[model samples]
Target: MNESKPLVEGAHFPLALSRPDLIPAARYSDPDFFALERDHLWTRTWQMACRLEEIPRVGDWVEYECLGRSVLVARVGEEELRGYHNACRHRGTQLGVGRGHSPNGFTCPFHGWCWNLDGSNRAVFAPEVFDPALLEPEALRLAEVRVETWGGCAWINFDDRAPPLRASLEPFATYHDALGVDRMHAESWFETIVPANWKLVAEAFMEGYHAEQTHPQLLARSAKSGYSAGTDPLGFVDPEDIVGSSLYFMRTLSEGMGGGMVHARDIEVAEELVRMDLPDDPVEALSEWTTRLNDEIRSRASAEGADMPDLNALLSSGHIHSVNFCFPHFWYLPVYGNAASYRIRPISPEETRFEVWTTTLWPAGDQASTPREPTRRPHDDPNWGEVLRQDFANLPRLQRGVRSPGFDAMRLARGVEGTIANFHQALDGFLAEREHADLLPALHGVSGPIDAPIRDLGL
Candidate 1:
């Protein structure tokens, strides 16, 4: 790994230091920094290209585009998938545009060059039209991109020398596996373009510190005692009526976020918990209520053959996170048996393409029919649930504010904002082109959910 360089004055996008708490302002708005990420981070990191369900059958394919490159991921055999650069070897024409089923194989629209499902050259349009050297079998084969599957998605890495996806994703993979994340599938998908740097947009969802102010509807207020400074912002339930307060909390959270954090069935389980006889002490009652609620939710889902994981076990093991961040550009909030996931991509220094998916477990074969394409909308559209609309309102303004001359670096909360800090630190390693062995430990530190003070990542 490169030694920590002293922060030089007037440097363009200087690399971050060993401390994972502060971030330079220029990293978010500078074109040169974005170019560095395009060349190093995006190309080397393992990124989710598409869900495995999207290409379940042989010959099924989807085109994934990033920066200016397009890759086609296709199922070639009953249990095998392959990825290839989307361009044809002949004339450099794109062979696929979007999701498709090519039972016969891909044929170039510009010319008559064709490639089989396994990325082997099938046939040339005419033998006499090209030089013999150009038609050599090895030269005509499609170029392959590295691909692997995990958590039900196909992840691709442009760098052939990059470590295997599982090895790079350490403790994060272990946690998600404990939660049965591989059994989950998208229930709804949506996309929008936000006028904000990709990191700015992603950082907005990395912490819960903004929830009390930005999403007032999600706040709990006492029914009898009314609002008071002593009231906990995290929970507003009145001690006198534990049942009513618990019900209100669950319903508001489920509705305000549009059913991703808490599913409809989870609400039903909470209602049943409220009716049972319990202790008179409000604190004890709340504790018992929470434990039973979690247990019942899992048992019911399992009884219905939903392949649900042991929520109580995961919680006791500390594997469950309200928000888990996979370094580079992915985050997911898992609650009950449902989860809400976010992915962001840079379009420019001030613009990003963001996507959200509401995911949950279903019967074995039921997820095959879920929609593969996200419904595109403008960032300001109100139809994005109450919680998200409130969150989106601040993105563009934050992007503009970061560029002010008087503003300097971001001051992140040591405890709540550790994910954001860890992200930038790991990014700096990539921009510096550090050795893979040195980078893996830092990547593991940045991989899991964040809710505590900054950790010594061994940078």
Candidate 2:
């Protein structure tokens, strides 16, 4: 539990913060609030810049852009990474556009000012053309941005005073580490521009309450046996049938998402599970099946020399949350040694860039190949899979609906939508510029996986 504290006692503009269950509707559509986030929230929080695999070799770099600012993250050595403001010191020219290699370090195209991968001043186009004092080492070195690596991704923070990445992540890091998340790498990556605020788009995936409504196919397929037999009001006519239904659920979930949630190998394990004899009672059978499924998945992956975790132990300890929300703008849903992830960034008050990646564990002792640049597509592109397409359909509608004159605020469900509330509360702490000591507790309360009711956020 977190200590309750009033972090936004005097906040006047956003009326929603006064109530725990309500979110200001204008926060999604108002330019003023968005600017506040640009100046306060984005500048201080740790955010995923790029997957480590994207820059496998030295001199490789990826430019991460958010709220009009750009950061260039580079691989300076086999185990070293560095980030710099993506602007040249001379005339403020932008340094890099996208991901690429610059073996000779970054050279400003405008005037040929150069900085090494370590951010030291390498050369200036014409030393005699400027004041010698201006060409000093401190003046010419690239402005540094804080860079840290975790979960196989490079994260950047603009504020030098911000806490270390791991310290800020807390139980979120502990949970992911238990699941072997750092060993997983991107198998596929894609991106699309969404017609909504970044927060609205991210909130869409923060809970399972919408599963039955928004993703009816998933619910229907997974629950077919529960309501299949008309004669059995309780849907327990045949206990043995539960095995078949469970198999179908896994199969359909994997197929519907186009291999986003469960990997092909997981489906194979499910197929194998149905061949075994099981208990006659449905509850007992399900219990046995779940235990075996988790164990077998880990065993099979480990047999192939892939780094795998003790899934049964993790499940018993309640370490698996299905969907983990890294505060502000990142999420990863890991299942059976495979996972799907999301990274969201604001493009404007009403537009956002959303990216998705499917990740899986690689064989131990072998480095995973570099993931190709994400393929950008329209928000409604079929290639995003049926589940995501269905989720995307609601984003534009929600964005437009929030602006209605009659709509007062977004009333969040106390239990199911707790993560959404947690997000806003943490954002308020930043926007209010609370002291680090005062804000750290609230950050810890909101920095882990979701699927549970709201906890005391110390705010």
Candidate 3:
């Protein structure tokens, strides 16, 4: 097989994905690999802890726990957010549980020690009994974790040396900033415990190649594939094989496979879809409809004296789908009218928590109808919708298949699965950070970076 040029070519994803070694199946099941990931990927990266709206009032706090580590994000003042390790200084007791408003700040139940909302040591009982020199109140302050806010959400990082949130997430922040993300509300939020590795759950959404086989209902709106046979053996149409620019369209900034024009004479459209206000051609009709809908939304938001950004600019520029895979655990799929985002966290080597949040712009008046705080439920819950259910149904099977002795590694379809390859390559970059350092002395006589050797060998 010939190797295709890496779509996301850079220091982030250095591996040539055509090589089979890029798929390290053990990373999905091995406890030792999981431990290494917990040490490097989880701790050294910034995580989206909670939305700013979730803790709107002063003294309100949300406990974000993952992989045996916990953090408490609290609103100490009107606009100030702070994060702490969630453990008391005395006897190492958890400071808070779940979400609540602590007016007088958090008081440890195990001991009488209290920490102020600002994470300062407030008071400890029996202070006189302990030596003041040995027990300085200043030394007993809650350990603080770095906290920052962007796109109306609070992010926490355990590593003090980690770069600022904006710096760490460059083009992603730039892309999301174009759309009025701060102005959008969390229309719906849901979470579920999936019985699959965290990586397996995340990879499901990174590519659209599985849509035809997994979500055949989506083809009803496609004019090109209107009851037509797909080209590939999997009975799914490959976007890169036809339609749109292979390099920049779907791979970088544009919409996914079905962005082309819709067929008017196609027989696949359902009776309900055919009778709708859409035009004769459904695909172009959907695009035009999306533009008109955004125009109406802009007018309504203006009429209601609400501040909303012009998302139509993205549509015009062909930067319509700002699909970004923020490293470690977040996926932001921001479109012109509707947006969906996902977060995955590991509960163990086998179970992971998957979070789905859908966002839309609504006039300020619609705030009353905004969905409630996200509640965790099973994936089969009716509220998850059909497409999501279909996507999740394959995760456990993937987990089981990857562990089989017959399957050594995955042969990635580089043409269509480039995004997934980029993800795996980036993950390898993270895992190789320290391993490459140990080889520096071996190349004392050699010059330049040491990664060239590793990348060439497909390591």
lDDT tens string, model 2, 1-459?
012333364344443376567776888988989998899889989999999889889999999999888999999998999999999998889888998899779988898888899999898887898898887899888999999988888999998888889888887888888878888877778899999998899889888888878876664221444564312223543445666666666666777666767877887887887777777766676677778988888888888988888878888898657788888898878888777889999999999999988888745234444466998999988776888888999999999999999886889889988988888888888888767676678888887777556666776
> For residues 1-459, what per-residue lDDT tens digits would candidate 3 score against the true structure?
114543223223222233533565666788877776787667777799987888989989999999989999999999999999988888899989888899679999997899889888888888888878857767888889999998778999988876678666655666677776776666667889998889888778766678679966544322334333332212213331222111212222212222211111111222113233544443445455445545655665566665657757776755555345666677666654335677889989889999877665545353345554677789766655666777778888999998998876676675555555555554544455533332222112111111112222123
- The lDDT values for all models are 0.78, 0.81, 0.63
Off by over 4 Å in 2: 1-7, 14-16, 220-225, 228-239, 362-370
Per-residue lDDT of 75 in model 3 = 95
> Which pairs of residues clash in candidate 1, taking residues 3 or more apart in a chain or in different chains?
none
> Model 3 lDDT vs. the true structure?
0.63
lDDT tens digits by residue: candidate 1, 1-459 = 013552221122454453466676777898988899899788899888888878878999999888887899998898888899988898789999989999678999886888888888998988797789888888888999998988778888899988999888777787777767788977778899999999899888778788778976665556655552322433434334666666776787777666677877788888777678767765676667677888898888888788888777787888557788888887768888788888888889889999888788744344445667889989899788778888889998998888989777788899988878877777777877777777788889888876645666565
Q: In candidate 3, list every pair of residues with a backbone clash.
A: 262-283
Assess every candidate by TM-score.
Answer: 0.92, 0.93, 0.77
Candidate number achieving the greatest lDDT relative to the actual structure: 2
**Clash count, predicted structure 3:** 1
User: Which segments of candidate 1 are over 4 A away from where they belong?
Assistant: 1-19, 220-222, 225-240, 364-369
